[model samples]
Target: MPEHSYLGLASAMHRLTELVIRAAMSELSFPSLSGRASCGLDAACGNGDHSIWLAQALLPEGQVTGLDICREGLLQARKASAKAGLADKLAYIQGDLHSLPFRDRAFDWAWCADCLWPGPKSQGFLGMDPMPVLEELVRVVRPGGLIAILFWSSQRLLPGHPYLEARLNATRAACYPFQEGGSFLDHILSAPVWLHQAGLEKIRGQTFVADLHTAVDGQAGDDLAACFQMLWGRAMPELSEADKAQFERLCHKSSPDFIANRPGYYGFITYTLFFGLVTSRPR
Candidate 1:
């Protein structure tokens, strides 16, 4: 497997956590039962930011276990868990989503964000379809367990918005087969309906919409540019040297104002978080 360094990717992922938090806060309602005293699970927890956040929110006696397919990501998550002094209450694991490697009904709350997309050819990570992974998440949680998931939505991000659009286009140009048809809605939103198929009840699905805001002359703008580069910029590497150079020149020319953080460069990027919850009843 080609080791993709997510160090840069992690930063963008953390920035997007705000979207996930808002989704969890609004879409999914906690049971009258205490979340703090409850145990939780984070599926496909890349770097574990969501897990750590949940731990802080549900602290006092709650524990959160984060699982990821990538070992490097898991290691980073473990470090974060420890740094937060949550090592004792938090756990990180390297595991396949198809086979969760944990017992059934193991948790009360489950959370996962933006992980249903097909893996890259170089990574050979998870496949395009998330059905198997979905089954596992449903299986691991006990009856009455609260399950919250956010999958990719429609093309709300700009050409400047990173990751999904670029990756889909690149893979298609390279002639790769993707199951979800390159749209976040096609992939992630399908989960709510899938949960119903899996016999999950009280299935509620909603789109959490938010706009990305960046100041013209601040760290957020710098971070946004860096993120766009890390996610979509890398796809240009596959271009021929001359083509890459011309493309870079074109990009620079077209987005001079945006790159320079001009006042008008600030624009709203809209995204919808597809969140679903299921009562832990037996199917």
Candidate 2:
């Protein structure tokens, strides 16, 4: 699992992605609640942003339970839920995604965002097999329920200044390797196959691009630059001193010599959401 402290930048990125997904979900005519109160499970719920959003969207009698392995994240999640006036509709628990603590058929639907990927321990450093996790989600969701998995596609650096682009490429190469001759995005794109093998029906996937570009003087630009800086700092152990310096210069939003001085200073990250229905459990 990623460290709890990583949520700051991650939360920022997630907020952007969630907005895109929320719009898509609305347009797709997602199912509406029936007679009984609707309930949902947010697996690996992080800071509970998604849980709260789910509750809001599924109202008037909807509730969401959020679970994560990171206690600190749940703490923040609880706080955010309270601040959003969604405390009554949202609940938080700390539990591993591999073996969820919920009972069979515990939720009407289950949601996992960026949590199905292999962790750091499995072969190729690609993480563990996601089958167990998917199975667990299947077990917890009632028949006819829905399961949604959202993840980021490989990042594409919009054509920026030459120096900045080179540094960004080097950073990406150092941080992410093409495991088994495929990039992380390739692995994510294969999730529908996993869902099928897990016995899910009505499996479907769609990609969304969140345009994160902003002018250097704007808050959005500063936030995105900060996220890049945080990522670079986390990868410092694997980065050369020269690379680190270059990243620092480029990510420094306030620096007069920053890369944003070049023409067309903007950034974007794409995300994809794959979802399926739990039609029935394997006998």
Candidate 3:
């Protein structure tokens, strides 16, 4: 990822997803994280928004260390922390999730987002097994500490307006190969099983739905539409000519025609969180 890349249109969609995750976090009951001067790790921290959130939430004397494989992401994360006046509370480092650079039991908790899916690709994809990475997270988090993973539960749009739903189906089909098991939903739904195999206990999961109605004409709605447009652009090579044209007709925000006729357009995406206690290291 590029420096300051997380501020772009595509990232806005990611931020929306995070918003849903934050709401879920607020509702879920977890052990008191604010009492002691505890430390936590934000694995695959990306631009570090979650790191900042973790630091603020775990504060008083608590700290959050953010680790990512992207150097530019870490740089941007550091800049963001400085901008937020959280440089002292948050630390950014560049490292691989499969082999974290921390000593055993370095953190009281570990949190990851959307980066654990297995796919065909190497650098970006999680490969055929995510156990190595989960084990690494467990290894660094102290026994009895919590591990949380938030990810998109499904790419398919839930039942909605027929036009928008069809477009979403096309979008998923175009992006099929890039996704794990031809669907991100499949991989995300299996998270509990993966966590269990990684030796985590007390596993729990939650799903949050974010609805974007373009007719509302808000910044968030516009941004969500733009994200779909971006996906369409990227998937153009895989899409048939007819599919491409239809996608553009429905999702292209830059089109003046689309701007003028924007009404009754709605989109829905779901995010899921899987959390548990790190009872022991992987056997």
| Cα lDDT tens digits for candidate 2, 119-230 | 4543222255688888999999988888888876645543555564455555543344334555444466788988988788889988877665455335565566655664
Clashing pairs in 1: 105-142, 143-280, 144-280
- Shift in Å, residue 203, candidate 3: 0.7
Reference-based TM-score of each model: 0.73, 0.81, 0.82
RMSD (CA, Å), candidate 2 to true, equals 3.8
Highest lDDT among the candidates is held by which one?
Answer: 3
Q: What lDDT does the true structure give each of the candidates?
A: 0.61, 0.70, 0.70
**Which whole-number lDDT from 0 to 100 does residue 191 have in model 1?**
70
- Backbone clashes in candidate 1 total 3
| Residue-level error in angstroms, candidate 3, position 42 | 0.7
Question: How many residue pairs clash (N, CA or C atoms closer than 3 angstroms) in each of the candidate models, in the order given?
Answer: 3, 2, 0
Cα misplacement distance, residue 38 of candidate 3 (Å)? 2.9
Query: When superposed on Cα atoms, how far off is each prediction in RMSD?
Result: 5.2, 3.8, 3.8
lDDT of 3 by residue, 1-283 (tens): 1123334543576655666766765543333743567788889888788787777666467788999888877888999899999999898888888889999999988889867766544345656577888999998988878899987665443233456445555564334434534544335578999899888989999888877665664675567556665444555666667766766665556756453145675556788889998885544
Off by over 4 Å in 1: 1-7, 16-27, 31-36, 118-125, 154-186, 234-256, 268-281
Q: Model 3: what TM-score?
A: 0.82
The lDDT, on a scale of 0 to 1, for candidate 1 is 0.61
Error of 1 at 106 (Å): 0.6
